[model samples]
Target: MSKNNTKSEGAEEEQPKGKTCFVIMPISDAEGYEPGHFKRVYEYIIKPACTKAGFTPVRADDIKKTNVIVIDILQRLLNSDMAICDLSSRNPNVLYELGVRQAFDMPVSFIKDEVTERIFDIQGFRDIPYNSSLRIDEVNKAVEDISENLKETFKSKGDDINSVIELLGITKAKLPDKVEISAETDLILKSINALSSRLSSLETKNVSFAAPKVVTNAANDISITFNAVDSVGQVVKVSDRVKHFKKGMGTVASIVSVGREIIVSIEFDSGDTGKYTNPVASVIKVINSDN
Candidate 1:
């Protein structure tokens, strides 16, 4: 290949939707006692610092809530260029997420209030320590420190492995062939939400629910969700086996996310590909309620 071709290949390799920094932390509802404490940490410290470090900071709040919270978190954890996890209070969910991120060779930084007990397992790992009192000066200093941490992390390109994958000498981590789905799904998700809202509004206004006449009657929507995991624990591709689709073998030709829910298009050997205005239960498993 020519030098220009090599340069273009490298450019294309970069994740095209800018960088995403997944923020994993305890939410107020999860830990009843810490009302407003965690929120302040993100607002005054983490988010600002991560944003300054040239990342679009995202958290669970970015994805609309649904029963598929785990799926949403896992997807973000897998796809983000970097991660900032708050170990404050040592919340179980936060720690679980931190463990998941550790398995990947991605940029990950930890944050914690100085008051929280030292997590013995990750004692050697670097973290941006903040004061529990959250005083402005202390917070500012923490931000500066975290910025330096981020700089070092980016410089290292997350090559320093810190998880079981590294310790066990596991060489083949199952990462996706492409991570471009996140950017496209963002638009698809927005469209789904818009349509959902309009449908809800019509129901409130006493309009009868109606399927459009132009609908393709033969096809249905199927989503390959977290439940559809293969033996290595990777999500099973719904599009991989269209021959036995109804017998629970298929793959997603396309997919869209609405809130915490994902809808996928699947085609069968019989030549039917289902598309729908709203996602529904699949042959593999039923979707959890939005509640």
Candidate 2:
């Protein structure tokens, strides 16, 4: 009997942990709120709620601070199994992160203090409201509400009621593909960084360097070339005219590289914007190249 019990315990211990719930909320103090208010909310409410919902809570601050980049945060926002977005204070960064999650039609629960007004655009979406006073009983109730909401949201799996994309009848954004960096591209990036550092050092020293113009020109050329080409070897750049099969004529607004794929955002003459992934040639024809 003892041996059987030991084996059962070991098997339980080997089970995988719960899914990650990325907490999108204000990390810093906001106006009209007390210092460390959000932190307390996370600790006393959000964290416990996520645990109750069988999710491991992850906040922006929980990620390794040293050498962290925007891409890391974006990847987390894009890929987390679920997210709990706090609309307290109506923070722009929080809203932006929520938009990114919504773009992918991911599961996310919205929470906010009772005082803050609902955002005009997303006002129709239901949000779990909590008392900002942080009273003990209220806090406990809020936790229950959030936990239950999280569970429901996860179970729905991007149903129309829970997804902005579905509500608006828009296409879901695709996840970035993983691409390895080539040796040549890596070398070019390093060289550019080194050149930029040298320029900064020279500027601080008040050195009237004549070599700057030549080096700067060369760096600009390299940067332009690097920015122009997509992962699939097609040259597409901002402000270039293009024709889309369905969207008709449009001009490129921006190009973003994520992992192995490049996303090109275009604003159509019809006043609609669209994002297409690499191998853009299949859907978009370059009418003119600004590059």
Q: Candidate 2: where is the Cα deviation over 4 Å?
A: 1-17, 181-291
Please provide, for model 1 over 240-291, each residue's C-alpha lDDT reduced to its tens digit, 9 standing for 90 to 100: 4432325443444665655544555665445666643433232333222221
TM-score of each: 0.53, 0.57
Model 1 CA deviation exceeding 4 Å by range:
1-17, 29-34, 65-67, 176-291
lDDT, model 1, position 146: 81
Backbone-clash count (model 1)? 6
Alpha carbon lDDT at 213, candidate 1: 18
Q: What TM-score, to 2 decimals, does candidate 1 have?
A: 0.53
Best by TM-score: 2
Best model number under lDDT: 2
Task: Give lDDT tens digits, candidate 2, residues 1-291.
Answer: 001132333343221147889999999999999999999999999999999988899898887732233556787887788899999999999999998888887878899998899898888778999999999999999999999888877765633356667677798988658768799987876676677667666566633211111111333421112222222323556788888888899998876666555667889999999986553354677787644
